[model samples]
Target chain A: MNSRLQAWLLALPATFFVVVCLGLPVLSTLATTFGEPAGPFVTYIQFFTSGFRRAVLLRTIEVAVITTAISLVVGFATAWVVARSPGRIKSILIIAAVFPLLTSVVVRSFAWMVILGKNGIINKALLALGILNEPLSMLYTEGSVIVAMVYLFVPLMILTLVGVLEGIPQDLTDAAASLGAPPSAAFRQVVLPMAVPGLIVGAVLVFTGSFTSYATPQLLGGDRQTMMGTFLYQRAMVTFDWVGASTIAAVMVVVTIATVLLMSRLARKLNPVVG
Target chain B: MKTRIHPALIAFSVFTFVFLIGPLIIIIGTAVSDTTFLTFPPQGFSMRWFANIFEVSAFPRTMVTSFTLAVLATTLSLMVGVPAAYALARFRIELPKFLANVFVLPILVPEIVLGFSLLKSVATGVGASIWTSLLIGHALLVLPYCVRVVGASLNSFDFSVEEAAVSLGCPRWKAFFVVVLPNIRAGVIAAFILAFITSINDVSVSIFLTGPGISTLPIQLLAHMEQFFDPTIAAVSVLLMGVTVAVMTVVEWTLGLTFLTK
Candidate 1:
């Protein structure tokens, strides 16, 4: 076969599979909201206009933003430590970050349930120390969801930031310090600016991961703190509200795509060389 | 002179490490607890919960399903993805960027959305079986990894050897099989392992795709946790972690963990 035909033939199966399995389904889901009898935008209007849904949307964004923010802060520190540490300790730290990633998210979230439940370690410890007479309910709360999400996603942030941080030489920071910039000033002026590309990538990953996450919010948040993921589940699987589910799915796709595009643009604008 | 990392930074890193790995340790600790309930620093030591994993009917059955699904999906993804990777790497294809984007688009979309979409369009609309939906979904999900990993390897590969083999009267296809495939073996294996782990561990996509008499291990575990607050879940989690560690060890040994970073 000619090279062009060979190339097309080689790419055919995967392209066909994706188009049929992924692209078509997603496009159909997006189209479902429009097919509603009332109007094309009816489901979307309900999604945005309804107080409950609006709350869920806002809460999803809130949890995702908080999770991303916390991941970035903690991840930067952890990544810095890992990047700057001697070779042996650095690999160990990298393993520490990568190991959790290998396990299931459901397993990780379940661990949080064990930790944050009413009779969980913290509650039991607090009660033993006479901090509280009664165990505080932590699971199913928004805070618990955020906490677990940060734990789940911080590793990703650390991995992303570690590569970029490792690329940055120690001399630059040392030179900054020698030139009268204090440690914090040196980090802010030198390290942080240079790390913006990694930070943006990490932020986007953590943000999108937490934003679209189903299990963590579902398992920990429960009905009391419904995020878009669980809400979409309930609508589709529980109630069979296809339009409603599709609307939520469509919104999620839009939000995720927007975030990715926005962040990439920001990364390009901030670090022209990397971009 | 090598500058010292600040004390506060070290302290923060320690805390973060603890925070990240603390829960897994707690689960493992709880698994060995002699107590019936889940507890950390666990009560007396016993292996009962580990044994109890077999007693849960769902765990074994769903584990088989998950394993089968993961293997099949990863294989399918590799079969589909490797050639595409080859084409993208070697051939001057029209719309290469668009095709690459299409391959990766599955991952770029939120997994939950993907799950729900498949459930709607495939399961409901097309009336496909749950197994078909899951297989298709998972294969699609892991295809990107195959393309990216294999593509990376193929990029760094020297194509001159393949050209030399073809110039020596070997068919182009045979040249690929003998010349290119063996050299990229490490990348292919790494991609397979990554895709396998991803398929087996996935809950978001599997959640919607699963039905009565069909569920993935993670979904089974989720349902089990919802109904029970015992150490069995912890036991299962620890076992899962063990499998993960073993898999990671294999990756580390064969390809090194650096492949994961790529």
Candidate 2:
């Protein structure tokens, strides 16, 4: 086959899979926004006008922002530790880092519910200490959702960082230290620049995971906090406003694709291999 | 050449261990609560709720549903994804490298969007069925990870060995089967295990694709969680956690832990 034909032929099966599964609805779901003309745009108008959807979107953004920041901080510490640790401990820590990710998301969310719910472990401990007169309502709030997401996703960030960090030669850091650069200074100047691309993509991953996640918000958040995913689900499945649901799905799909593409471009500039 | 780890990093890693494993500890604790109602630090211990999972027919059926779907979908994804990945990686095609990226982007899209999209397409293309729709949907969900694992392996590969075999007067198919297949084994295994774990644990997609009579483990947990707050959920979670640990251990053993780092 001609190389171009070869390329297309090589890519065709996977492309077909993506086209049928991902590309199709991403295009079709937008039409769901227009609603049946014979019917009304009332669902679209209602969904947009509702302060509830606005609040949910805002909260989702807020949660995503917080998740990115916290996971970055904790993930950095974990990655740094794993990078510098002895081989045996490093392997053990790596296993620990990956365990949460391998488990079912639903299982982990329920694990959080047990940890955070009223009359759950944290509350009982607090009550025993007389710190609180009654068990606190910790579950079904914005906090639980973010915590679960961070716990679920931080390992991903750490993994990427470890890979990038390992690629950077240790000699550079040693040379910096030999020149009297402080340990902290060595990291700030020598390590961070090389690690920037990995960290940025990692940030995007954590951010997007939090933003689009449906189950985490539904199981963990209070009813008052409806994220876009939960919001889309309520519209399509619960309220049966197929169009409104489809509109939100379309917007979400576009946003997700655009964000990743934008990041990949920036990543390519940072590390040419990513392109 | 000396390579020594800093002790400060050890202290920091101790904290990492706590945050990662703490929730599992708390969940298992609550499962044995002696109270008539759920209690945090159980006044006493019992296996009542663990037994309760069996009493509730939903739990057993959900487990069966999750395993069946995971096995079927992972198998379908492997059959499709392996060849596509082979073609992309081994062949020196003139396509833009971005075609490779396009193959893997499905991993990043949220489950909710995927669920709705799959539902719409399946309904439109062929009336949604319990098996076919779920199979295709889960295959889509697992496809990207499989391709990435296999594709990365292919990119850094040595093609000369395969050519060496072809030049030895072996048939073309024999050259590919004998020379190329064995080399990319780790990546293929990684892809399969990832597909299996992901397909098994998925909730967002299953909730949409599943019918009234069909329910998966995550959805099973979701329904139980919605109506009641109890330790049974935790018992089930611990059970699930055991499976998670085992699968990950197997994957790490079979495919080196850093297999994807390449």
Candidate 3:
């Protein structure tokens, strides 16, 4: 066979699979929204105008933003400290940091239920302290949802930031310190600025992860809260409204693409050198 | 240059590590608890729950189904992904960037969207069976990883080795099978293991794709949680966590965990 034909033959199976499995389904779902009672643009109109969906959309974005912000700050500090630790300690610390990401999200969510439930660890500790007359209601709340999400995704942020932190030279920080800057100033002026690309990448990942996550909020948020993910599940599975589900799914894709574009553009403006 | 360790940084790191690991620790503790109701810091200790998993018929059935799905998905993904990676690595083919991005679109797209979309298509008869739907969904999700890991390995390999084999009168296909394949064995193996683990632990896409009378382990566990809150799920979760740690340890020992971290 000729070289071009050989490459095509080699590529055929994956191409076929992607088209059949991914491309067609995604396109068809997006196409389905254009049909049915509400029709294409009308469904988008109704969805945005409706109070319940609008709140779910806003709440999803709000949770994602908070989760990403907390994950980034905590991740940056953890990554910095892990990067600075000595040999064996550093290796162990890195292993410990990433240990959570290896396990299933289902497992992680289940564990969080035990810790945050009414008679769970945190409430038990508080009751023991005599800080409250009764067990504080911690589980099935919006705060628990955020806590679960932040806990689930912070390790990812740390892993991303660690890679960036490792890339920076020690001499730059030392140079800043020698110029009468304290450790904090050196970190803020030299290290933080250099890690912008990592921050941008990590931020997009954590935000997208939190936004699309179904299990964390489902188990922790209880009946009172409904994020976009659970909302999508309910629309498609519970209500059997394929059109509404497809529209929501499409909106998620658009929002994710928008966030990535916005973040990358912002990163480019902040530091033209990296890209 | 001398560097000083900040006490505050150490404290913060310690606290973060605890937060990350504290939940899993609680699950393990709950597994061995003597009392029920998902209590932590157990009233006493027992292995009864671990043995109790066998009494639950759905648990074992779901375990078998999940393992079978993961294995099949891994095999199919590798079959599709390996040659695709080879083509991408070897030739400056047409729409090269586009092809690369197409393989990667699965990662960029929200998985919940993917699941919902696939659910609609399957219901409308895009796929012939629920088994096929779940398999296709899983294989697509793990497809990017297979291409990525194998492609990275291919990039680091010397193309001239295969060229030398072809020049020495070896047929093109034989050159790939006998000469090139052996060299990239580590990458192929790593890709397979990674794909298998991903398929096994996956819940998001499988949640929508699962059908009547067939459920993956995660889905079964989720369904179980909806009705009953007990140590049985914790015991199962602890076992699953053990399996994950074992698989990841193998990956780390063999490939340095960079495939995951990167």
lDDT: which candidate is best? 1
Model 1 Cα shift for residue B156 (angstroms): 1.0
DockQ of each: 0.78, 0.60, 0.70
Better of 1 and 3 by TM-score: 1
Q: CA lDDT of B17 in candidate 2? A: 72
Candidate 1 C-alpha lDDT tens digits along A1-275 = 67788889999999999998898999999998899889788888888889999999999999999999999999998899888999888878888888999999988999999889998999999999999999999999999999999989988989898999888999999899889999889988889889999999999999999999999999899999999999999999899888889999999999999999999989889993664
Two-way lDDT contest, 1 vs 2, winner: 1
Q: TM-score, chain A, per candidate?
A: 0.96, 0.89, 0.94
Model 1 interface DockQ: 0.78
**Candidate 3 per-residue C-alpha lDDT over A1-275 given as tens digits, one digit per residue, 9 for 90 to 100:** 67888888888899988887788888888887778664559889988999999999999999999999999999998998877777688777777766788788999998888898888888888888998779878887888999999999998998898878878889888889889998788877788889998999999999999999998888998668899999989988999887889989988989998998999898998783654
- Report the poorest 10 consecutive residues by lDDT, candidate 3 chain B: B253-262
Scored against the true structure, residue B202 in model 3 reaches a CA lDDT of: 89
Question: What docking class should model 1 receive?
Answer: medium
Estimate every model's Cα lDDT from 0 to 1.
0.91, 0.78, 0.87
Candidate no. 3 TM-score: 0.96
Chain A alone, model 3, TM-score? Answer: 0.94
Measured on C-alpha atoms, candidate 3 has an lDDT of 0.87
